[model samples]
Target: MNPSHRLSTFNITTLALGLAFLYLPIVILVIYSFNASRLVTVWGGWSLRWYFEFFNDQAMLDAAWMSLRVAVTSASLATLLGTLAALALSRGADFTGRTLFSGMLYAPLVMPEVITGLSLLLLFVALGAGRGFWTVTIAHTTLTMCFVAVVVQSRLTSLDPTLEEAAMDLGCNPARAFAAVTLPLILPSIAAGWMLAFTLSLDDLVIASFTTGPGSATLPIRIYSEVRLGVKPEINAICTLVIALIAAVIIVASLAAKLSDARGESGAPL
Candidate 1:
C-alpha cells in the first residue's frame, strides 16, 4: 500500500475510534431508556415505560424545574457580569491590581471544582447565608462567569475599537455608542457566553452538591443520589432528554447563525 494511503486509513480509523469512544456510551444510554425492564443491561424490548416514569417522578420533575430556573438565572447573571469583566480586561487601561483581577477572573476555569465548591460553602456558612435555591444560583453564577468572560473576551479582543469611536464621533455618548455599535457586534459572543454558562450550570454536580440545601437539589444532585442506588432506566431517560435539549439548542443556534451569515455575504458589495 502507498504510504500516504496507509496513513489516511490510520487517521480515519483513529477518528472513528475516538468518536465512538466518546459517544457510544451516550448512544447506549439513549437506547436503553426505552427498555421495558428495570435492568439496564438486559434488553427487554423497546417501550416508553421509563420516559413515562420519568415524567411521573414528581421529585425528579420538581428538581428539573428548579434546575431550569437556576440555569436561566445563573446564565443571565453570569453573562452580564462576565461581559463587564471582559470589557474591562480587554478595553480598560492598565491599573493597579489589574493583574490580580485577571488572574482571579480566570482562576475558576483551572481550579478544582471541589475546592471552589468547598470554599463557597465555607464562605456561605461564615456569612450566615442560608443554603438553598439562591445559594445554588449564586454558586453557579460565580463558577460559570469565568467561562463566559473567556468567551466574551476572545470576541472583544478581536473587535474593532474604531466602530465605537465612530459612534462617539457621530455625537453618541459612551453608553449610547456601545448600545448602538459595540453591543450589536458583540451580541453573538454574549449569546454564546450565555449558552455556555447555561450548559455548565445545568451539568454541574460538584459545586451544586456542596452548596445545595435539601429543598434546592438540582437535577444533577437528584440524579447522583439515584445513581448511588444503582442504575435505572429512568436515569437513562433523563440523560436522553438532557442530551436532546442541548442538541436542539445547538442546532437552532447554528442554523440561525448560518442564515445570518448568508444574508450578510449576499448583501456585501462586490
Candidate 2:
C-alpha cells in the first residue's frame, strides 16, 4: 500500500482498538443486565427480571432521585457561576489580581477529587454544618464549575468582540449588547458546559462518598455498597439505566448545538 493508505489503515485500526478498549466492558455489563440468573458471573439466560427489581427497589429509587436532584441543581448553579467567571476573564478590563483570580478559577480543574472532597469535608466540619443533600450539591458545584468555566472561556476566546462593539455603537448598552449579540453566540458553549457539569455530578463517586452524610447516599454510593457484598444483575440494570440517561443527555446537547448553529447560519434573532 502507498504511505497515505498505510497511515489511514493504521489510524482506523487504532480507533477501533481504542473504542473496544473503552466500551467492551460496558457492553458486557449491559448484556448481562438482562441475565436471568442471580449470579452475576453466570449466564443462565436472558430476561428483564433485574430491571423490574431495580425499579421496585425503593432505596435505589430514592438514591437515584437524590442524585438527579443534586446533579440538576449543581449543574445549573455551576453553569451560571462559570459563565460569569468566563465573561469576567475574557471580556472584563484587566484589574489587580486578575492573574491570581484566573488561576483560582481554574484550580479545581487540575485539583485531585480526593483533595477537593477532603477540603470541603473539613470546611463543613469546621463550620459545624451538617453534611447532607445541600452539602453534596455544593461539593459537586465546586468541582464542576471549573469544567464549565473552561468550556465557556474557550468559546469566549474565539468569539468576535467586534459584534458586541458594533451593537454597543448602535445605541445598545454593554449589557444590552451582550444580551442581543454576544450571548446568543456563546449559548451553545454554555449549554455544552451545563451538560458536562450535569454528567460529572451524576457520575461522581469519590467526592460524593467523602462529602455525603448518612441517609443521603447517591446512586453510585449505593451501588458501591451493594457491589462490596457482591455484584448482582440489579446493579448492572441500574448502571445500564445511568448509561442510557447520560447518552440521552449527550444526544440532546448535540441536537441543541446543531440547532444553534443552524439558527446562526439562518440569521435568526437572538
TM-score of each: 0.94, 0.95
Residue 69, candidate 2: how far off, in angstroms? 0.5
Question: Over the stretch 45-71, how does candidate 2's per-residue lDDT look in tens digits?
Answer: 999999999889999999999999999
User: What is candidate 2's CA lDDT for residue 197?
Assistant: 97
lDDT of each: 0.92, 0.93
For model 2 the TM-score comes to: 0.95
Per-candidate clashes, comma-separated: 0, 0
lDDT, model 2? 0.93
Give the winner by lDDT.
2
Question: Per-residue lDDT tens digits of candidate 1, residues 133-202?
Answer: 9999999999999999999999988988998999899899999999977886787788889989999999
After aligning candidate 2 to the native by TM-score, how far in Å is the CA of 203 from where it should be? 1.1
Q: Identify the runs in model 1 with alpha carbons over 4 angstroms from their true place.
A: 1-7, 263-270
